[model samples]
Target chain A: MALADARAICPDLATRPADLVREATTLAALRRWAGRYSPMVARDGPDGLMADITGVAHLFGGEAELRADLHARLARAGMAAQSAVAGTFGGAHALARHGGGIIPDGALADRLGPLPVAALRIDHDTAEALGRLGLRRIGDLIPRARAPLARRFGPGLVGRLDQALGYRPEPVAPEAEPPHFGVRLSLPDPVGLQSDVMAGLARLLERLCEKLGRHHAGARRLRLELDRVDHAGVQVEIGLAGAMRDPARIAALFEKGVEEVDAGFGIEAMRLVATVTEPLAPAQIGPARAAPQDGMDDLITRLGNRLGFETIQRLAPAESLIPERSFQVLAAAWSRAAPADRPGGPPRPVMIFPPEPVMAAPGHPPARFRWRRMALTTLRATGPERIAPEWWLDDPAWRSGLRDYWRIETREGPRLWLFHTPQAPAWSAQGVFA
Target chain B: MRCERAGSGALQLAPTRVHEAEGFGRHAFALFQSVCHDGPVVWVGPAHAPERLLLAGLPQGVGERLHIVRAGGVDLLWAVEEALRAAPVGLVVAELETALSLTAGRRLQLAAEAGGTTGLVLIRQGAGSNAAQTRWHCAPRPGAGADSTLHQWSLIKNKRGTLGDWTLHWDGTSAAFHLVAETGERRGPAPPPL
Candidate 1:
């Protein structure tokens, strides 16, 4: 409509340019507010929201009561909204857009019989084509043969009809519901005190732990987000040394980080999310003495977060024959102590140094060898234990091919491990058997 | 003298700058083996760490509990301090190439106290000065014991209050140490393996 025509309808017609920022903020805040209604709430389009209320309606005293309470909450917030709950997303969406109310389960056809073909939510052109064919009501399409209608109007119309009638499956992809383990609280009044923040954390932890327990999982890392009254957000992340489901232990680990939370003008809201989680089951059998395991984990976690866990580690034994690859270093917090070395294997050097080439005098045991600027006479020599390279792996050290290793005692009293690879036709000092 | 209580004191394992390659690893690892039975270990070193050297002297499971951190000298102190706070950490060892200031040493001590974890600072080449609980000088006496690395360890500085000398014979079989002499005295090629 022209500005003059719009002005004629309402002489004092006023307008302002659209603010994308304000619209985005409103949508974000709306999504946040919709959490209490269900964990899975998503903005459907520019002016609509889809909720997977599945098993949550009974909490507010059945479907009708929940629907009434939701409408009342919207009215109080001064945001007008129309909602419909159906067994399927298709049914709910169609009912909501075309004057929605409570649609009983198993009555999608009966309840939508009188509604126009537009209720199927097809494109306007498809609806107009169906209208021209005298199939104006959804009930008209439901009773007729599906194949004929599909051939005539195409699958778009058939799909819309099937979806609305609850034949096709519809799954709502909620906007990443803040990691399923998250819980948020909107304060009755903005609180700035440390005690208030702690209390808020307590409440959030309780709910989060309950959910975590139901899922049989433990949080390995947590992020506490404080939404201040001034619109500033403070996020403090705390990592766990091990998976933990105990609320008290998790709370204790987070005490230091939370103390650093800048309240700003006061926190109007708070959100706690378990960013990393792992499957954890309660101890089936208690330890004979609990003194060691629990306390040690706490200490490791506290120190790891305070300093950095990567700085702490345990040597994990790797299943390999190569000296350098025999053991793997793992984060101390996440790994267990490696088992004792198996006996009867060739005596391997405790310390495996980087390999260096050797210049040797030609002989069965190489009578003399020079390495690291020192020439040593091999007075005593042992076996030529052959170690072949793993065919599946590409190791630079092993690129020289098969090796014949010999344990030799140098004139200088250094017990050394030297290997000769025929592929390279060269000898190299592999380790210092100190 | 090793195996200090976790989180109670910060000790120094100083290998004379002159002979780092000769004995630094032997005694540092022996010290690590001494206390590792109590808990886990975190060994923080500089980039291009010779980690395999540190664990090689100790026996299988004993060395398996060591966690390694490779950072530069600038971040060494921070890594050591943080390691001191890791509760289950029985020991935190840093292979430092530079000298540690008194303030840095004091901060490490305070952190150890807070975390109740012990700090073992391994200096490749350090001056004879520190407020650490103890300072040791380790040298490899390769022919000193029967097939064992007889490390001639002298108590160069004993802040725990005793400057005693001892020869720690590292038994490769058990991955443990046996004090050979209290006088810290040794003869050339002392007796063949028993």
Candidate 2:
């Protein structure tokens, strides 16, 4: 409806532009607060709340008592809220908006039949169409054959009807809160020295590790935030290849990072947070199995902290016929070290890249060619190893068609892997066997 | 040049020492040395020369225990030193396109000594000297037959053993190096001009 029409209908109406993002944020905060009622509270549309209070309603004496307490609390918080309790989420959603009440298990259909067709959660168009057909009430459509209603309005109409009548399951999925693991320390006397910062960091780590120990979790990534007296502050973040919780080892890892953080006038506060964590089982010093942890993991973690973890990789074989797709590069931090199965078949070049164009005169294998600004004479040629592209995969690089690979030994001291695409009629160098 | 088959004793790159190889086949020789050890191998590739080995082309044993590390220009040496110091690995191979200082080389050597790991540095360009235990210059010998490829290796500087040169043949099928003898005109101080 236009604003002018709404104002003509009710000249005293209040109006404000809708801020959807802010509204969503406020609703999300409200949902978090509603967690006090039940762990399974979920947002019911934009203005209502759906809470599965099956076993929890007894704690508040009864469903009516719980609703009274909720209404009292919401009123005290200066927000008007409407809520409905039913056996089904659809039933609850519809009733909360149309008529508020509690419908027992078997009485759901009896209570929902009196509501308008719009209460079935169908769109306004479907409701208006149902009204034209004299099926304005949910009870009016309940007795009709489902196939006709489905054929007339599409499957969504029947699906929503079934969901509302408890014939279909409509479970409420609540959003979970993220875990928080952080510790902070405020200094009485501002200190700027690196040693002083290290001391403060150690204290924060001690408390943070205790918290992690209780949860049987270990930090995989951590950040240290320093609040300077005069400057904005600085943050040092480090990612470990594996989970760790030891204070000494963690402190050692932060040595370089702490040294680089400038302490502007002086340090006022320090906070250390584990932004990422993983489950880690406690280890007992057992006989024979107590050989010190593998040094490779430590090495990887230490290096990963400085040079991003993704930069360290291992090669693993992938089942593919394409030359470039034959091997997979996996992050060494997360991937288990597996022995590579020696690739079978013809010899492959030691190094390979995307085929770079080469200047060559017409020939099966060019007798002489220019590549990378170097003119070289071909001493001999070895192969016409034909490799066809995988038909199922539409790779842009392989669109050049059937490739005839050749091992050409140049007059200079280098062997190059050159290919000729028959379909495209061009020659390119893809690799070198150094 | 006339070359004879080297003596029976294999080329021994002692563990816990830094060895340098330069020239065309430097990377290949470094990989060859890496597989000889027992544990993991870390290949530190500098950003400037981002050369990588085709896994499918590598020999069966080469890919199983290899970990490739890509580091920036300045971090290249630092990563190598860190890998050397953490020495549980069998070998650390660093490809150096930029010049390496004597101090950096000595630090790498000390780290290798402390960790008991062998360090092989593949000098791609420049002819800078370092405190490496041995320095090798290698190149491919042209006209190698269809079945086998030849790489000429000259040990220019050997701190522990005598300096020498040899030609080794790489058999495609077996994936092993065999010392071969070459008979040709000598180039260094051999025959007087007629």
Q: Largest lDDT belongs to which candidate? A: 2
True contacts kept of each: 0.41, 0.66
Deviation (Å) of B102 in candidate 2 = 2.3
Please give the interface root mean square deviation for model 2, in Å.
Answer: 2.1
Model 1: how large is the Cα RMSD against the reference? 11.4
| Candidate 1 docking classification | acceptable
What is the Cα-based lDDT of residue A358 in candidate 1? Answer: 90
Misplaced by over 4 Å in model 1 are A1-180, A187-203, A210-216, A246-266, A282-291, A299-312, A358-383, A408-416, B1-22, B25-28, B53-60, B113-116, B127-129, B144-149, B160-169, B175-194
Please give the range of 10 consecutive residues that has the lowest summed lDDT in model 1 chain A.
A337-346
Docking class of 2: medium
Candidate 2 per-residue lDDT, tens place, A1-434, comes to 99999999999999999999999889988889889989997877776677888699999999889989999999999988777888888888888888698888898878888999998888999999999999988889888999999999999999998888889998878766655799999999889899999999999999998888878899999999999998587999988777888787788889899999888789999999999999988767567431223577778888888888988889998888778888899989988877776677777887787789999976779988999898878888888999999999898999989999998888786778999999999999998775
lDDT of 1 at B99: 70
lDDT of 1: 0.71
Weakest 10 consecutive residues, lDDT, candidate 1 chain B?
B13-22
